[model samples]
Target: EYLHFNLFKENKDTFEANTIITRLLGLRTGASSVTFAGTKDKRGVTVQRACLRCVDHERLATVNQRLQGIRLGTFAYAKEPLRLGQLKGNRFTIIVRQIQPTAAAATLAGDALRAALQKRVIDEFAEKGFVNYFGMQRFGTRDIGTHQAGILMLAGQWQETINLIMAPKSGESATITAARAQWAEHHDAKAALAMGFSSLYGSAERALLQWYARHPELRHDPHAALFSALPRNLRTMYLHAYQSWIWNQIVSIRLDRYGPTARKGDLVLVDPAVDDVDDELVSAVDAASAAPKEDADAVPRVAVRALTAEEAAQTSMFDVVVPKPGWNVTYPDFLLPHYQSLMAQHQLDPLDMRRKWHECSLPGDYRHVLGRPRDVTVAFQRYTDPQRPLVPTDLDQITEAPTKFRAAPAPFQALPDVGPYDALILGFTLGTSQYATVALREIVEAD
Candidate 1:
């Protein structure tokens, strides 16, 4: 029989064991393992509780030092694992310990989560001497501006963690000394169930538990009770659907250029909210990864279709459309003649349009607004001074006049009568959903 046990500071007295089990399990960091080694069942208590202990203050302290360096959430892991009585508490000490994983492996939940757990462990032991189990946030910033350097540090903390993984040596003391961040995230996730902070794990636990179910051996465990109240299948569908929502929102904001589209359990570290604080991090990653976010180079070269002799002065809405390079300027069937006029006024030569020419970027791509509705999209359209951005369209067309009707002034051109190219097509929903996609991108990437 397998017993998942968590150990903690037991007041030096064995009987008062369950006192803080709730707190221990609430942490969102670190890995824990429990084995029945052998249970000494006594008659004093009844509600099943777990028996576990902290590994060592030094190991924990080392982790804490690493945590202070990066600055996300890391205070939880310093405590011990919390044990729940598989059998209602009858006082008994279950031999349990924190072990390390063998290899660098990926856990679908994501790496930011693992770093979170490590941060907790480090904090718990910081009272004593230590070394970082989570590695360092040190990265080169020779070209980044001074202000951007600080922003890069803040934002790239997670991205830089891509290097912090502790590869357990044969002589290492822990089970998984420093497994891949993903593995720690999963292990910590299971450990966190013992903690009271279960709500923080809403979607993650469901996905992991489902993955655990694939192994018939663990499937029968009572842990299934955690999700029994929800639909039998809702657990499986949560992640994918959530990710789809995220991708849709990001697409709507035009921030799908970053690591967009999430599957049920895919690992994504780009959060738009953080971008505001560390805007340069995204730029740094993008600059290094080439123009991956825009994949501007990937568009296939399509042969331009020449207008037919009779179609030269075409009458159809689509007829007026001349596919411009790099612009999403297709004339949808829904476009009206009034829109053409709007488009002409909106149009500018190549140098005048910074975005289409790949001239600028939002602080971050919007990932948070996924599945959620957005009312508007904003961006720095003129790019240069006046420096004012423009609102291409109301995503929902919900804004009232004067209240939300204020749009940035654009330098008007002598445009021919035409339809609006920069308009919203709500009959169909886009992933980002708005023409001024920068805000949509912002929305999509929000925490």
Candidate 2:
């Protein structure tokens, strides 16, 4: 049986949290034993369900004490280990700091003004919902977007793809950044490995450097050998991110062209019963290696179909979807021209995503055009200190221990008088793949 636990983490990414647990449980057993439903942001406090194979509750409970910013509890046994896209949704309690008054609200003062602004935002969001454009986080905050690397990969540019992946970034350590800069300028793999990388962040770069070090001359399967050094998910993520980039732009075009309402030739799910539709992609490496099977049950449970004008008239924005752009998926007839035009700009053929290297071959998926949060609740509060805790975490509620987990303050009540800063405590539940940041953007009208 899999030992399931509720993982509460503050300011740590999913990979960091999982790595800590893997060591405590014994890493020799393998990192694959630890699994989670989804990845959460590294900026804030997040609580999610996770499962570990071949671990006991007592040993798992010990992890809570060993960890500083992480806590594991609510232990139990399950028949299956947690997999990606396993959760129905995520419940978020976000504190939007430094809430500024709009030009219209400049004249109004204190709680009266707060009430007016809150009601306006709540009412509009409840009715219209937000555009389901993928957040900027998906593309990454870098000079070269992740999708650019995928484009190079698909076009059969191995050296360029590797160089792009090894490019220096703003926040990395000086030593590693210098090493990357040297590699970018000199293209010397041996020199990069000689510099040494001890930080976990440089793990992928180190692996690639090491690979290139051994094979000074790339003669056979160089691309496959280099790519195989990275994790399967990381390798596949480049292609997926490329799809996301296209999807985001197309969704914006759809909104601008036809507005939020459903239109003729828009795609919808073939099986409306499947609400938790997720992009469950197999690694191209795995797909290429495994023998082709003819199992009828292996077909996707949720397929898409375009709507007729008559059917479109009866459809809601919620039912409408846009293709992620793959060989298998169908694009809307009206938007096909726009899609082709966009692909042409990148020197890619939209109809054919297949490449000589199997890793670049993509089978696309679909995403909803609009995302609306469920049971959304918002409140405003005035605070003198920005460092104060805004919301209590899951660990704060259950345990009374004197650890940092017990230090969280309760949600601040709205006051009549104005303070130094205004804060918005927003709570909502979003379905799988829906971004909480996107929902907030609709209310705040911020980029």
In terms of TM-score, the best-performing candidate is: 2
Off by over 4 Å in 2: 23-25, 29-31, 61-68, 182-196, 201-203, 210-221, 277-298, 356-359, 394-420
Clashes of 1: 64
lDDT of 2 by residue, 52-145 (tens): 9878887777666678788877678989888876677888788888876678777776677678667866787755777877777676665778
TM-score of each: 0.17, 0.84
lDDT of 1 by residue, 101-220 (tens): 213423422234335333432332222211111101111112221222222222323222111211222443232233323344554434333332233222223334334435445433
Model 1 residue runs over 4 Å out of place are 1-189, 192-197, 201-206, 210-432, 435-447
- The ten-residue window of minimal lDDT in model 1 covers 131-140
What is the Å distance of residue 172 in model 2 from its true position? 2.5
What TM-score does candidate 2 reach?
Answer: 0.84
